[model samples]
Target: MWLSNSSCEEVVVSAWGSGSEIGVEGDILRKVEKRVKELGQWEKDVFGNVKSELSRLRKEIAKEERIAMGDKNTRYFHSCATKRFRKNSMEGIRDEGGVWRTSQEDIGEVMVNYYKSLYTSTDRRVSTGILDFVSTLIDEEMNESLCREFEASEVASALQQMAPLEEPSPDGMPPLFYQHFWSTVNNDVTSPILSWLNSEGLNGLIKKAELQGEIHGYSLCRRGPKLTHLLFADDSFIFCKATMEECDNVLEILKKYEEASGQKMNRSKTSLFFSKAIPEEVKHEIKAALGVPEILHYEKYLGLPSLLGRGKKESFDYIKEKVWRKLQGWEAKLLSQVGREVLIKAVIQAIPTYTMRCFKLLASLCNEIEALIKRFWWGQRGDRRKVHWVKWEEMTKSKTIGGMGFQDLAMFNDSLLAKQAWRLLNNKTSLFYKVFKARFFPNSSLLEAADSRMGSYAWKSILRGRDIIQRGAIWRVGSGEKINIWQQLWLPRKHPTIPLICPLESFENHTVDSLIDPSTRTWNEQLVDGLFVEEDAMLIKKIPFSRNVAEDTLYWPYSTSGNYTCKFGYRFFKEEEELQLNAQTPPICHKHVWKEVWQMQAPPKIKKIFFGEHARMYFQQNMH
Candidate 1:
């Protein structure tokens, strides 16, 4: 029952039937193949039943009974036992004296001594002056948040945040085990964690320091928000001027925090980055004062460059290498076309997605990535090229149309970058937005801000994304003061939201507010009708005003929610390209025909064949 006949038949039939158009099979041979699929399904069913019975037996055995059964009695237990010992074994340990100890006794003694030293505390004294420098950053609201009771959801989320296949816990269960069996273990796991959190309990101290003028933070521009510290989970980045006083203050704050919170800093892991302007002697002095080594550049933080320099391609070449490694392990020759399609979309395409969300990759690099995917799709390996039957551009079109629903990497990257830009457009309260706004456009809004030659690579990339938003986004009327009636696209209509009638010289600078009655906070019908043509006037009058007369804001009309999404943004560009292409070339298939092909009762694999063959025949007969 685990492997049903109908389900297995569908998968096998689809894989086998994909090439049925190229060669014809007789009714008897088709019947025999159908029987073979059924047999394969039945064989899988038999195996599933046996596996189920074995699992039941293993579960029913008590802890004592399992130990008595021994490794020799069950291959499953034997494998688990062997793997545990092999992976967990300690071969040797190097002592502090730089000698490698091979014996078990020496290794145990070394471990004990190391942990003893690690846990042991040294006498420390804090001057009253240092304590005075530390301000009261935690308020009543923050204190309450720290002291609040824990929820079951928080417990589950913490466990889920851990890597699924990471090393096993003390109980020999990896995170994957708990995640897989969460439903069964939920109450048991939740109760203990909640109890501990309720018993024990839990700011940006650097910001308060900056406010008190005890410390200073680096800024990109004079007007921008100063960059003091960045914190995400356990990672922290601290910025301050290169001075002994500043360094002492920072160290004191950290010491005070550690003493109060019982959480110790990993000094070995902490690193200091100094600007080139700082003198070499001063750098060394600060490093000694802070008790952390100085580094020219960080290796990586959260799997991304902490600071991107002039060499952008070199900085991001790792993405290309990662994609290549993924392709190397996959056997294109063994996988079905459908299987390949799934892997390419889900795995390969997803590899660059995280990086793309933060940076706009070079177009050449995007093309190179797409080339690797194209080769794999056509069964290419190790410099052996396969003839590409269709253009990559055609392949990226929607499945409901004539092509596979593959992403166009370049457009997809822009779409992702546009999403970041959209966030800045809307989330003005975010730290990122505030910092960028101060640095790049202190006086102007993101929409009206122009690209500058002096801008950083990230700033420039965001501006490129802004181009897409500008094309699709229109003003959602609120107060109507910000939207110009003749110039801006404010009317909620399918086409030509702006005025069709040319504006008279007298009314050239009129805003939407000119047509709004101030008393009623509604459209002045007489003014609207006089200014625009009937269609434009009708659309303008239909737009409802906010009850409270809210400020005018930008919105994308293509989406029902009116908010920008990467999916909708990417699709909008692709659809626009299709529209332009259709305008130039004669149509091969009607909209209703393609709709029917997609809506057919046939399986998707067969439906693809139907569309492919029809398109091929149509092109051969007409375009050729």
Candidate 2:
């Protein structure tokens, strides 16, 4: 049955029988309209039923669409897709003669010629001066092996390394097809890829330029690594001295790269970012020389600022605006309480997560975001004010602890930023860490790093995150040589970092390594028992030592993997806050029973309703 749900029609068409017969929909709808118009009660009932059915159908359709998109953030995905389309759609191209080619045929010709010039190489001989600088690291035997003809076994081995479902070539055959039908297509595949079929790619050209000293790169600090360029997939960021000579050299590198790689440079899309030290006249000359746009202040790279200036809150305000826009959508108003919760957690909270991972947002901004979410949660739309039944702080608690399990944005933000600090602590070998270490705190480790008074905003944000790490991180006992028993948090237990009883005057200066027996890589049980109180002794004795005598390592005890994660970090702070609050206030009666009520396996709305009813009944009976 072909049922059309077109809004323009008075009534939709539907088939009654299983075959091609049409239903008597016209007569039925006429009768329904007549009955609906005749009696006021009947009219009301019929209109209400129709409205309900229509709403249900719309909801079902929306649900199916969401499922088909394969993303819970369907609105977010749609927004991105729309933005990408607007940005990527090419209206026209300017030819070499400076005339716009708007027609498809003209544009096609321009593209073909542009790429043809890039791929087609001139028969110019290479200069011996440039080639002389190249070092031959390969031996004669290794060179011969590399230049040898390919074998079927070698071809099959290479094919096996590729993912089976990887995107196919122009032939529309994926890796899986070749692997599965190897017996049938082996001959056709192995013969074409000769060793002589070779060309220098963009990377090779860049490396040669670097080796010949034709290009220079800047360093984060005097002793840091000189970063010439950074390439993430298709996006590229090139660094060089702000001079006419360096700019010319960079342009020349790009010119050679285009010829070798069959890729045309999009000058209109390219931009040059200059430091404030560079003169305005020099900036103009450089922009004109490169034939690219000039970014006066900053531009976004992968949705984040490529360069951050003094106003951090202004730079990151887009995240807040994005959340507001998402909440303002009509779908948000239609969503149920459960739906709103999912949207807030999965989409709205995640909007800032990527930004938070790199920078610590202002406390004011976090509170504003929380206010927007809270307003939506309490059914306050536009100018209409609604009474908030529960406080946001109470709602931020876990569901099992008599709250809605909503994320506390400020805490979550700190946790996400702490992840960056965690990375810095664990991955000291990474280029990011090396650069930051050289610039901010070359003399100290991340744990001991003091705030740099004249550091970048990013450095300052990371230090804020380091505070959270400082609070929650405890050392895992290994060889324990570097850990001090008094200053550091080495104990495995939650509450206390040190022994319950104060350390003895002589023991305060000792390392954890002093407590371990040298002969058997185990804790000196007798010494531990004698030195501390019973409680401290039991906790210290329970901590197992590594058999191989590894170095003492810091770990977050809240997580199973001993690594600091955003979830565990936020929870740790929340628990600490709760502990402090509990200590200040009197204890509640039958707290465990109330906790059970919150933890019940029912819909949140139903549970809230049941609790309200139960509370009312209890108060009424007590009053009687």
Candidate 3:
């Protein structure tokens, strides 16, 4: 039978018999038969004895299946259905251990395709400028070489005698000899050589290049026999990839560009990083270019240590420590000169919007300053008493608070660090964490345990302050009872029949169960009762005809008789005269026994709490 029912008994039997009829192999069919028999026995022996258990298990399985299907649908909707749903579900998936995977090869293919399309779409003529320039230079060089070859035999005798002329000056030389030599040599030289001599001219072409706007600045220079490659700021990667002769040829071209540009090369910024041993002639040329006593194996420039040895980590540490020490010294000097205020401001400027630690440090430093001020100037101050009582909020507030507004570094640092939470949530793939892995914590971890170096005293102090704040005092206003909609202010139609007040000592201890349970009482029941007494009983001096209670005895409805009424004073009375008489003499108004009236005028203590000197001052200050 092809059972359509989804029940376990029916599905299992159908799957087993269907397997038997499919002409499956003997072993497979036997295994299926054995499993079916076992399942049938289990149904008869285990399930039949526990009737409700089977039904409950079925219900549970169905519920779980429904949930699984719903979750699968949610994932599919996010990935293929809508962009908004995809964004919303991404966080949920990540939290649920789901990871999106893409192949590096696929990424590379996409990048290559995009570049190829871009190149193909471009105009050929516009893209041929570089090739054309290189070709023209090569043609000129070839022409010069051919000309030199043609004139070599004729010029041999003249060049032979000219070599021994010693100290031949351009101005002092005989006119005929000078003209013949200059014309032969200048005309025979390759264009690359001519360009190099004209532009670089041996002095350095960095200045020329800068003047021509070809380079922002000269980065490096390495000399070669008859030429030098002066690296401009525009060139990120420049290295000799050919033999010594080819290198020299390339250097000649580079020199020509440099000489024409008028920018001087910075030999200090340059170095030769060869995979194989360099030629002696090339080394000599490089020495001449750099003017150093000798070429060192390694050197550092712009705070980056050159990678020449295996001690890369050590080298980095050496440079980093030196820089950090120097910064610290500078900070100390700045602190001394400008005082803590300007020093803190400078630190803040350096860190700006990057970390909350900066602000916390500022706040901590302020606390330190306050402590110091109190120790040194408290007793000696004119307004000593007043200064001690000054609230931190008031002290940090603007002049309107009767004190100068100064930054509280502790609070500032906590708030700043708190921003990191937002940053991490937003930028999951920033390189800052990658570069300084130890400085930042991994996701889903607390900041306190992160392996951040306490590089600065201010930063350490800020962290300490943050720890204290995490453990500091917390006050809550509400009964442990969960309020319904009527009790909430936003739900205007929903007002609590009676307001429930509870003080939460520990935030973590508060829960929905504790809030919903009305019977749960707090240690400070009197305080809660004072704030939320039934409206009807608020003005009642006593319950009439009750011998067990005195005239001024107070009773909450639940604590009193079971038949007692619960109402507020305002809702209880319909007339002002009745309210006044009831307040003056309760128990005389029997007709309005269900109601109690409170005088519109509040009691002395209530007046003190609401309209006393402090309250009046607060009201007047905020009146505008």
What is the C-alpha local distance difference test score of each model? 0.74, 0.72, 0.36
Q: In model 1, how large is the Cα lDDT of residue 241?
A: 88
> Which 10 consecutive residues of model 2 have the lowest summed lDDT?
8-17
Superposed Cα deviation of residue 98, candidate 3 (Å): 24
Off by over 4 Å in 2: 1-145, 148-200, 331-333, 495-510, 516-531, 584-624
428-459 per-residue lDDT for model 3 (tens digits): 34543332223333332223344245333333
Give the clash total for candidate 2. Answer: 0
**Model 1 alpha-carbon drift over 4 Å, by segment:** 1-214, 255-269, 288-298, 495-501, 584-608, 611-623
Question: In candidate 3, where is summed lDDT lowest over 10 consecutive residues?
Answer: 547-556
- Cα deviation at 448, candidate 2, in Å, is 0.7
How many angstroms is residue 117 displaced in model 1 relative to the true structure, after the best TM-score fit?
59
- Cα RMSD for predicted model 3: 38.5
Hey, what RMSD does candidate 2 come out at? 19.6
For each candidate, what TM-score against the reference?
0.64, 0.67, 0.22
| Alpha-carbon lDDT of model 2 | 0.72
- Model 3: runs farther than 4 Å from truth? 1-393, 398-404, 436-624
Q: Give one digit per residue, the lDDT tens place, for model 1 in 104-135.
A: 55578789999988998675676889989998
Model 1 Cα displacement at 208 (Å)?
6.8
Q: Which RMSD values do the candidates have, in order?
A: 22.8, 19.6, 38.5
